[model samples]
Target chain A: MPKLINKNTVITNPWTVMKASTGPEILQVVPGKNFIVPLQFWKLYQEELNEYDGNIAVWLDSDENPEQISDELHSLPLIALNFPVFSDGRSYTNARELRQKYAFKGEIRAIGDVLRDQLYYMAQCGFDTFEIRHDQEAELCLQAFNDFETGYQSTVAEPVPLFRRR
Target chain B: MYRYDGYDHQMLADRVAQFRDQTNRYIDGKLSEIEFLPLRLQNGLYVQRLAPMLRIAVPYGMLSSTQLRKLAYIANHYDKGYAHFTTRQNIQYNWPALVDVPDLLADLAEVEMHAIQTSGNCIRNTTTDQFAGAAPDELEDSRAYCEIIRQWSSFHPEFAYLPRKFKIAVCGTVDDQAATQVHDIGIYIVKGDNDEIGFRILVGGGLGRTPVIGKEIFDFVEKKHLLTALEAILRVYNREGRRDNKYKARIKILVKETGVEEFKNKVTKEWALIKDSSLTLTDEEIDRCQKFFDAPNYQELSNTPTQLTDKLQSNILFAAWHSQNVKPHKVTGYSIVTVCFKETGVAPGDVTDRQLEQIADLSDEYSFGEIRISHKQNIVMADVRQDQLFELWKALESGAMASNNLGLLTDLICCPGGDFCALANAKSIPIAEAIQRKFDDHEELTNIGEMNLNISGCMNACGHHHVGNIGILGVDKKGEEYYQVSLGGSSKNNASLGKIIGPSFAQEEIPDVVETIVGVYKEKRIGEEKFIDTYNRIGIDPFKEKVYAKAD
Candidate 1:
């Protein structure tokens, strides 16, 4: 099992992230396992997913708006924001909107293209957990959170900008 | 100038330490070059043609003597013995080792400076009028708001990784010396109907492959709602801006594609949610930032004193310099002296380590230990006493900084193009040099006065060619270099982008083309009309016909 940073601590990730497979075949939801589905897949098969006994969470791609799941937010345990590439930053806005705009209290996890250098900023944008990219050492990446003790702008961690706080 | 408090010091220290670790990781091969690109760029490091260019941020172009001296030391010790002041009011060191950057950053941190957010797909250094505090026509000192924006935009976690690089410029004066109209976000500090200070916000303006003037997004945003409003705009851009193509990723494209009205509506909707949040500025905080930019202690005296008048009458050189380089200061007895960097053979904005130290000393002696870097890539001693004009002129002349051409054709803004930049299509320095040599006669240049000649090596438009009165863009013609000339751009209160005159010219013919264009302006002028005035009055057709006719 791969380890992920959850709420600033490394832990074994229980949820299996299902990416859209090659070709147009629809992804099947396996029973009795924690699974995070793509937002479109989750939305398309919500009734079928509701009948399954497995714990289901929705994941959004960089282009997917978090508002799609706003109506049923309280039911999901986690909402994963995908980076596709670390430089593609739309997911950061998605995470912030999930937390601040939609008031989604469930876990907001950063998935795909996640790296040590971006962990601090990801955390700042209301991402409670990060699924460290498979190539990165998750244990060492834990130290990324402490890279900056403070920032000037308002963040999920600190809602007040530095000027107001000062 | 705003002095660093403990919090500011701590933040910079943490940033330096963070960069040091990132550098070590890269050296150890733990982080791949692809992954390290944004990390290095966010710290203002770029792998250029010759060496790694490190751009150090001078917030709102304000520099204290101490900071200037520190930069001089860095130039002398860390990299080459020279530095280039960029069009964004930041300074770029062209030759610096990638390994030594962390230590260089540490040295800069000691002077309350860092290279953070100077580049990369993040919010860049916020710029303002070089004469923000000293200009006679200023509504209020724009530096305070620039400082405010600087703090808000610095390491803005969500906006840090935007689709493209963002720029914001603030103008407090009636005259737009900062060239705000061409920035991603141009802020004009204005008075509300009730006399409350606020900002007129313009969005989507940029200069690059596609140059577009900013649209007025909001007529007035109250002082308190500034950051929140900016936040809304950034949020809209961050989520919706084009990321598929880097060339079309600027906010301008989004504004254009979405239509300005629709974009404005989106931003307005977003702003309503966050406008009254904790990010809203308190009067105390505003005052706190404002206090740092308060007027310097001025000894009141006559505008042009007896001593200055006598010196101006006695020496023609001093008189010429005063007539061109000096401008009236908001405070009587003081004058704003532009220390020209456009010497005939030199790169427009390049300054030697020795010149940097000399400028620091000069600032301390003549301008209350303060200096400003103009967007035109020149230095300004904003508070020089009029009585000491002769002495200052003599000092500047001795240092070879007293070129009596503040706005003449020779005082051009040319980018460090093919010589240093990896993206350049052609060399801009030689072209700038050729034009400067052609227009070397002081009397002729004075007659062809107050014209902006800007050159960019590529479509990046770092030299601000889009807003220059006369502009040049270097293009790669079948792997060979050619130059495209444009006419009638102005980056003032009424900003306008230049129009391309005609077909491109070979490198050798650029000087003659410029001369022919200037000739047309000189001949067509009714009376005392500037190059831009004449070009605008007669239009580009006359100049285009004459240049091509001469070519045939």
Candidate 2:
């Protein structure tokens, strides 16, 4: 698994993405491994997912509504939003909605097509952890976190805007 | 005029260094050409038909004398000894090397300026009225608000990767001289019912292949809520804006697809969550930016100076220039003078290095060491005394910057067409020259009255042909260059797109066709009616019948 960088520091990645499957074994979570179920699959097997003993997480596509999973968010360790393309940027808003609107305190992760160039902005919009592509250099990408020392507008991390501070 | 603090200064330095690293990576082949295209564009670098072109932002069309001198230095030492001002109130260097661009940006960053967001899918320059603070009829100065928006949008986290080039314009009056109706987002600063200052927000207005006047999203948004409302709109656009098709991905398409009321609902929904956040401007913050745009010191003098009256009585050319080039100002003794770069045969907005330095010197001598670039492609000195108008006119005439045509037919709003841009269909410069030569006589053009003749070499509408009174578009017919004509478009208060006239004309016939169109306008017009007014009164059919009368 690729290393997860959260807030400019590398962290151990524990969650394994569970592909959509209806197998009998799919409902049984491994004792040590955490499973990140897609929102669709999670909706279909909510009771099965809730009963599992290991850590549980939810991942969403660009079209998935954040409000749909709000009740289940308390049972999850983190919410990962998939970026089909880096330029699409729908997931950034999804992340923002998760943090600001729903008040989801658990970790917010960005996955799929995530790149080094976009990590800084993702961080600004409230993504704490990034699941970078396996082939990319994670350490080098982390440098983007501090690309600019300051920003004019406020973000999730910095509540006071530059203008307000001035 | 907004001064940069240490934080802004360091950010600029860091951005330049980041770009230099990106350039190095591209040169090392670590980043492919396709991968580097958007990166270079965000920095205002374009690989054109000729050499690479670099466009530098002049925020809200305001530039200091020191900035102009720095530009002159760049033009003389780096590229050719000239720079071209664009319709969006920015300057373009035609021949900067691809590698030298980062160095050029470093030079620009020294003077509290950089080329960030000048060209990209992100938000471009925030243009305002050239006479923003000076115009007597304006309600409030819009420059500080524009500066606020600029800072907010610059390197914005979510909005840096928008679908297409986004343009925003602000105007402080009903005049709409900045062509607010044709930008992506337009802000009109106005007084509310209780005499409170607010903005009338318009969104999705643009002038490309699909010409649409922006719809008013909000009739009034309070001053503190400006950033929140804007953020909401941008967030909606970023999340829901079409990304599959490059051409159909502008916010206009999203606004069109969602409908205005529906789009407003979506933005209002987003605004509810972020309205009370840190983005809301404090009164102190507003006052901080407003202080920079405060009025310059002026000496008490007569509105009608004796020297100016003597010059007007003696020199006919000087009097004619004063009547056209000078605009009324808020101050009694001062007037805003537009130093026209449209000297008949020369390109509309091209200025040489020497002229740049000289204009800087002129700004120091006459105006308060500041210059403004108008959307109509001209330079403005806003604080010149009426007594010094004659002397300023004399200096402008010596440098071939004195042209009495401010809004006439020869004052062409044209793009660097097939000559410089790779995407153009024909040569726009030669077309401008041809039309200028055709109407070389001062008396004939003056008789024609107020008319707009805009030219673009392609459908991208950089020349804003869609909003011109008499619009011309260059089309590629087989292998030859052909010109298409449109009539009755206006970007003023009553914003409307031009209708295409029948049959395209060849290069040689363009001037004659323009003359024929103008001939119909002059004949059909009532006493002292402008061309747009005449076209609006007597529909396009009469002129269509006249010009295509011979061809058909």
For TM-score, the strongest prediction is: 1
Candidate 2 iRMS, in Å?
1.3
Q: Write the per-residue lDDT of candidate 1 for residues B240-280, one digit (tens) a residue.
A: 99999999999999999999999999999989888888888
Candidate 1 at A1: error in angstroms?
3.4
Report the Cα lDDT for residue B441, model 1.
95
Candidate 2 lDDT over residue span B305-406, tens digit each: 898899999999999899888988889889999987788778878989999999999999999999999888899999999999999998988887889988
lDDT of each: 0.91, 0.88
Clashing residue pairs for model 1: none
Tell me the DockQ of each model, to 2 decimals: 0.84, 0.67
**Which regions of candidate 2 are displaced past 4 Å?**
A18-32, A51-54
- Candidate 1 residue A153 C-alpha distance from true site, Å: 1.4
User: What TM-score applies to chain A of candidate 1?
Assistant: 0.91
